[model samples]
Target: MANIIAVVWDFDKTLVDGYMQDPIFEEYNVESKEFWKEVNSLPDKYMKEQGVLVNPDTVYLNQFIRYAKNGTFKGLTNKKLFEFGKKLKFYKGIPDIFEKTKKLIEEDSKYKEYDIKVEHYIVSTGMTQVIKGSSVMPYVEHVWGCELIEGEDKDGAPCISEIGYTIDNTSKTRALFEINKGVHSGDSREGVNANTKIPEEFRRVHFINMVYVADGPSDIPAFSVLNKNGGATFAIYPKGDLRALSQVEQMRVEGRINMYAEADYSEGTMAYMWICNKITEFADRIRKEERDKIAKYAGSQGPKHLVD
Candidate 1:
């Protein structure tokens, strides 16, 4: 039987467009462009005062999630996040990309020989409800991302709180650790159940075996963890965005990711083909190694018919 290949992805910028900008803002009646303009101005108005360089978008979004958690804004409740989720748009070719990927995996003889089951998962700091509401929800096994604690307002109306949503590395890390416990221990070769806790002593499989797709600094820790440990991280950017592409290259140089690609799904596109080929190649290599190990052990046993 062939080994399983698990493809873990980050939501938003990676799998789909980063909606932190448009629809999300529009849904809440916030001026999208102005919000980003103010976000960009923060470094000069705030961070620079403290002798720090800040990416306003990151700071702004982080703060917004915090404020939303505190109920300072009306209609920005956790449920609203899901309602807003329905309006998100994709860059281009996302739906086709997934369909093509599935076809490629199912048709590849090598994948079939190895019993390779391409299990796709979403690991994000974005809200799970938003992911569930997205079009891709049907294809993925589950989404592991920031979650809200559902409760009620003083008037007994439904309310949402980011009290437990992961917005920072520490929280994100914990969420990742808990969601995919076997990653930390490495011993989950057999498989993992969603609700089961990970056992100690097994480190998660290397990212080389995983094609991690993500965007932004919040994804850095997860990206870095995969890259440093031999897994591959692909930093996705909007098509023709030179600046974001530059950032992806910087991350590559910094050893946070392995490659950069436009979020396109055309045949032979780097993202699709590379991942497809690499998965087959990985399976072949593992097979050869295991065979070699078995051969070595057999040799040590000498002639089976010979009496000891």
Candidate 2:
């Protein structure tokens, strides 16, 4: 059986104080509010003018390209996106929590015996280049996000020209399965589609071994996927931001998220405590499963009096 526990995360408000791409807007002097206003309107705008119903989640990538081509976001390139990532203000405990969670499975003798390990992944609708450049990237095992294709602009400067791939809210489920099946690790060549034939015992990481953390309603699709499949979900709302809190609270009431916490992920914060507890629980459960399996086949479970 695979001894892996995956903690998948959503970007944006979940990790940083605000959007990861906010630096892009600030750097280019583009009004972030106005750009988002346009992004929010594009789907309906296209449907009305051309009868094409676009994906609201990732249509912003096209707008990013449009701005680059028009010189509004002049010289916006993958390199620039990476630079912007460094400016992001990540919430408290971020990358530290990543390493801490992984270490949890190693501290206990029982946990260590089973070889259970935690792997961190980011599945976001934000820019991949930006996420890769963030302070937290060093702790992350893999990232899934909207990627940009770079090409030469008129001045022969490399610029972001096209949307290479998009991991919208709905598609985040696929990334989860990719983790579940170990696709990103290159252990499962059959891909996520081969899941039905792959038994739970053999799959890289079972759904029960996953914990998904995100921000709001846009994560409903991902939340539902994990909830329905026996995984856990946690929501993070900005501290003192009632609107953000309300959004997550409503999701909890709707059964989308298993729990909600303030964005601070510091060592003693709710987010940190809850996540660590979940990891401990998952490790213990895996230990039990492994022990039970061995006992079943060996027909020897040691002495009941000696069992703790």
**Residues 55-145 of candidate 1: C-alpha lDDT, one tens digit per residue:** 4323565456544555544446666776666777875666566555565666777556545455567776566677777777666765666
Per candidate, the number of residue pairs that clash is: 10, 0
Mind giving the per-residue lDDT tens digits that candidate 2 earns over 1-308?
76888999999999989998788888888899999998999999999999998999999999998888777888999988988888998998978999888777877777888788888999999999999999988778899999999986666677899888888998898898878777776365653562456666667889988999999999898888889999999999998999989888888888989999999999999999999999988888889999999889899656667666
Query: Would you estimate the TM-scores of all the predictions?
Result: 0.72, 0.93
Candidate 2 off by > 4 Å: 186-197, 300-308
Residue pairs in candidate 2 whose N, alpha carbon or C atoms collide under 3 angstroms: none
